[model samples]
Target: MTVQEFIEFKIISFGDYFVTPLHIMQMVILIIVSWTIILISKQVVQRQINSGRFDKGRGKALFQILNYSIIVLTIIAGLDMVGVKITLLLAGSAALLVGVGLGLQQVFNDIVSGILLLFEGTVTVGDIIELNNIVGKVEKISIRTSKIETRDGIVIIVPNSKLVSDNVINWSHNRSVTRFRIKVGVAYGSDVSLVMKLLSDSALEHPEVVRTPEPKARFIDFGESSLDFELLFYSKRMFDIEFVRSDIRVKIDQKFRENNITIPFPQRDLHFKTSDTFSIDKTK
Candidate 1:
């Protein structure tokens, strides 16, 4: 048989739709071309990202969108080449799709939310975020969920809908540095001026602390048994903030001890109204 006759030989048939060697070959070629386009697009996008011509998160998101679009178009073209009526097929599956959509409402919601996240750029990879009291750095964002690596190095997958519908704190969104405060109370009658100076100095001693904003010591209030003071400092380390705070606390403790500034414990005074009541308790 000639090559053209062999290529046109029908391999499968169903109603008006039929698959032939020619159709299969065409699909193979189409897929190869589509894959080449996707690869080239990825390379271009990565180059732009590397060159700082595009934001990494947004660029990746855009590339994924383009890749998926191309694949979908390729599928439609291949089906058409095989004599599959795209419009009729969709019409036939309309009822089934509705049923599936209803059953998978949350899944659909998450998928849509994922698309929103990628488009809006509100939440992205490498951002330090806090949700449901859990703080972590986003490692990946996909169509249905996101992966977050916590401060403890535990990775957690969070549904995209939750990120969109719930309140989230993005520490690295507006700026790199975030201000954190440590509250400490000194023993009553301890030199307030000395306490403030110590708090400021201890925070400044930390290398991670920002110097341009300058560490601040606020004499917040007078507690029942101590003088409350707050030490505020800015740092670029959001994920490791707990360690930074701990280091500052250690420094504050050492400084307070060296300066004889005591952190007083909670104190409560009791008054004895009658000795008779105490004697009754002893008898019982």
Candidate 2:
């Protein structure tokens, strides 16, 4: 048979729909062209993002939208080539779609939340955030979920809906430096001035700590057995802040030991009153 006649030969026929070799060729070509377009577009977008022309997160979001649109269009074109009527297909599946939508309500919610995150630019890549008391850095955000890498180097998948609905603390938002505190209790008789000085000096000595804002020591309150003091300092290293805090604590301990400032433990005094009703058994 001639090539044109072979191309027109139907492979499968069902009522009003049929598939031909021409249709198969068209679908293959469409997929190849669509893939090429997306690959090229992705490279262009990446260059723009790397050049700092726009925010990285927003650029990624824009690319995602474009990519999804292309895939949808490719699907429509493939279906059309295979003699499938898009409108008729949608009309026939309307009821089925409704049922599926109801069952996947939370999935739809997450998709919407992801869109909001991409558009709002509130939560972006590389941001140190605390959600549900689990602190991590945002690595990626997709249509239904986000990838976060915790301090322990563990990657966790979180639903986007939770990100939108929960109270999340974005530490690296707007400001690079975040303030942290370390609490210490000293013996009551320890010189308050000396304690404050030691706390401030220890924080100041750390290279990670910000000096412009200046670390300060606050005499919070007088406890039952010791004087409570808090050392507050700001640092740009939010991801590994625990390490900074540890180093500062080490410094503070060294300073306190050198100055003879004792970190007192909780102490309680008890007085015994001999009474007929509450007598202790001397021999048991």
> What lDDT does the true structure give each of the candidates?
0.90, 0.92
List residue ranges in candidate 2 displaced over 4 A: 277-284
Q: Which lDDT tens digits does candidate 2 get at residues 1-284? A: 99999999999999988999998889899999999999998999899999989567667877877787899999998998887989999999999999999999999999999988887878888789999888999999998999999999999999999889999999987777899999999998999998999999999999999997999999999999999999999999999899999999999999999999999878999999987787889998
TM-score of each: 0.91, 0.85
lDDT of 1 by residue, 197-242 (tens): 9999999999999997999999999789989999999999899899
Q: Candidate 2, after superposition: displacement of residue 63 in Å?
A: 3.0
- Give me the displacement of residue 258 in model 2, in angstroms: 1.5
Candidate 1 stretches greater than 4 Å from native: 275-284
Of candidate 2, the 10-residue stretch with the lowest lDDT total is 54-63
